[model samples]
Target: MEILKLTEKNIQDEHICCAISDKKCADGYQKKKDWLKTEFKNGYNFQKVDVRGKVFIEYVPIESSWLPLVGKNFMVINCFWVSGQFKGHGNGKKLLQQCIKDSKEKGMDGIVAISSDKKRPFMTDPKFLKYQGFEIVDEAPPFFKLWGIKTNPKAEFPKIMESAKSGTCPDKKGITAYYSNTCPFTDYYTNQVLREYAEKKNIPLTINHISSKADGQKMPIPWIINSVFYKGELVSLEMKVERHLDKLI
Candidate 1:
């Protein structure tokens, strides 16, 4: 299968591999496209398989990465996925290799990605990355792990921020969420569904839209893009059903 790279010039005409046919997420999709255009200026890259499915990888230099990690001359993978039927066809390997090749050509010291200790929603599988020669460089509370494969042995390993290490939100009395345009489902759920539900239930909700890399870096949740914290505890990383939110609250 041919792998297509998304450039600023071609992003509008291409499908971002997630929420391709979901009308509800159309606004979120456009928001992500706009976000991508800005990131492209900072050396971010987005590539996906030619097939019509969620098979893609997005990465950027650690200096410009949205995640709170400290490392120099390294590439940070924001998202890497090969979903559904695309899983067992070696597409994941090829996509990873492409990142590796690109990193090397750019004189990067290594590549790093965020994962979880167990299988979790909206996070890459640590076992798969481990099998691909990545080592656990650091870990944060609530099961977030930083995995890396260093081309240079002496390169500094990446670590999660101290704020995220606790996995506890300061606001302990309501539904607090930190989100961004990175995911297409976030805006719809947070803005419309979640707000309506919270209002109906008389629950105070605080939704923080992450607008910059700095906001993401300081987020209490390791996965800042779409994380919900209820009563000071990390609840979910993806949009949840009303029943789920009720239960969490």
Candidate 2:
């Protein structure tokens, strides 16, 4: 049950293999590594895999090109995978919960997802995110575009954060989180801001690791998964999470 961070040192280990069983994929670790390095430079954060034993969730994150809603603070879940042997046992739900918790605790504005025709089977299976209270926010034929299904923070972030920074904003905290199939720090502003509030609220962080940038209407940016935690708790501070945005920019 370890969602360890993927670094150059650990990418070639058994954990990655456990994440993806495809022999071809395991051999492509070098290409993956090279991609991660380049993606990190482009605001794309990714990890090797979401592994719990032989099972794992492989995916990536995408930057919001939609503005405010998909602002620089948010991400779109493009790819998702559960090991063939680990399907249908609540692992997917746990994986999904991890993403929700991460977004809440990390104080990320939100997570977005576009279901691919390939994964449409599972993504549209209704039971995927519905039981968790996730709703279909948008759908554009052929595929469904779901946003804010888990934690939609609202549209008041701008006005709210502007006034909150001066009133004892919040302190950042040390978190046990998930990122890039590997663990990443506060390099991205969204992560940094969210992590800061975890200290204030105290929670645990579990993020979705975005694994690739090969976007073909399925995989988006190299991103972390969906959730984060702080002090082992889940808290939604979206509107208030950006208290320091102005000064930081």
Candidate 3:
């Protein structure tokens, strides 16, 4: 499969791989594109398969990354996904190789990714990373794991921030969520769908948007795409709706 990089010049016409034809996420999709436009200048890279599906990888320099990781000269993978019929093909490996090639060319020490002990939504598969020669360098509460593959073995391994180790947000009230346009579903779900659900259910909701690298680095959870907390406990990281909220409330 041909891999295409989404540069600022071509991003306006390229589909971001996720939410390709989903009407509910149209506004969120544009928001994510806008977010990518700004981050592209900060060394962010988004690469995807030529086909129209969720087969893509996004990475950036660790220093310029929105992830809450501490490292030097490493490339942080913000998102890596191969969904639906795109699986079983070598698309994921190809996308990862592109990231590796880019990192090497840029003289990055290594590549790091945020995954979990097992497969979960919005988190990379640790098994896949391990298969690709990545090692679990650090781990946080509730299964958040940091995986790294260092081209320069002597370089420092990346670590999750101390703040994100808690695995819970500060808000211990009804419902608190931290989100960003990193994923196309976050903006609409957090601001519109969930907000209305919370209001109708009379549940308090607080939405925190990570609009900058500084804010992202200080987030309570390592998964910044979208995190919902209820009464100080993590509820879910995926974009949720009324049924999900019903069980929570």
Candidate 4:
């Protein structure tokens, strides 16, 4: 299968992996594209398979990454997804190899990604990452982990910033959500769907948009796509629905 690299020239015409035909996330999709456009200048790379399915990988220089990770000369994987019929087809490996190659070519120390001890929604699978030779470099709170494969043995290992380790937001009351257009579903889910759900349930909700890299780095959680904190502690990172909220609240 051929790999398509999204550059400033072709990104406008390409369909990013997730929410390909999702109407509800149309605005969020465009916003994610806008966000990518800005990051591309900072050495962000997004590549996907030639097929019309959710099979893609996106990475950037760690310094330009929004996650609160501290590393020098490393490439931070923002997202890596392979789903549907694409699974078990080696498409995921191909995309990952491309990222590894690109990072090595750029003289980066290594490549790192946000994952967890186990499978979790919207997180890189730790097992898969481990199979590909990445080792746990740092960890945070309940289960968040940073995984990496270093090309330079002497390079400093990446770590989650002190701010992200707390796993709790400063807002000590109500349901506070922080989000960014990093994913196509976040804007729609956080602003419209969840907002309406909270109102219907008579739950106080506050949504904050992490518009800039500086703001994102200050976020309490590494998963900036969507994070909901209840009474100062993290409740969930998944873009929750009414059914899910019923159990949590």
By lDDT, the candidates rank as: 3, 4, 1, 2
Tens digit per residue, CA lDDT, model 3, 9-66 = 9999989989988899999999999999999999999999999889999999998988
- Tens digits of per-residue lDDT for model 2, 25-134: 34344444555555444544333235444443433333422111233344544344465656776766766656656556656666655442234332333455555564
Worst 10 residues of 2 by lDDT: 160-169
How accurate locally is residue 195 in candidate 2, as Cα lDDT from 0 to 100?
61
lDDT, candidate 4, at 206: 89
Question: Which residue pairs show backbone clashes in model 4?
Answer: none
* Clashing residue pairs for model 3: none
Better of 1 and 2 by TM-score: 1
Task: Score residue 226 of candidate 2 by CA lDDT.
Answer: 29
Give TM per candidate.
0.97, 0.47, 0.96, 0.97
Worst 10 residues of 1 by lDDT: 240-249
Give stretches of model 1 more than 4 Å off.
Answer: none
Where is model 2 more than 4 Å wrong at Cα?
14-29, 40-54, 58-72, 116-126, 150-152, 156-249
Tell me the lDDT of model 1 at 177: 80
RMSD of 1: 1.1
Compute the lDDT of residue 35 as modeled in candidate 4. Answer: 90
Best by lDDT: 3
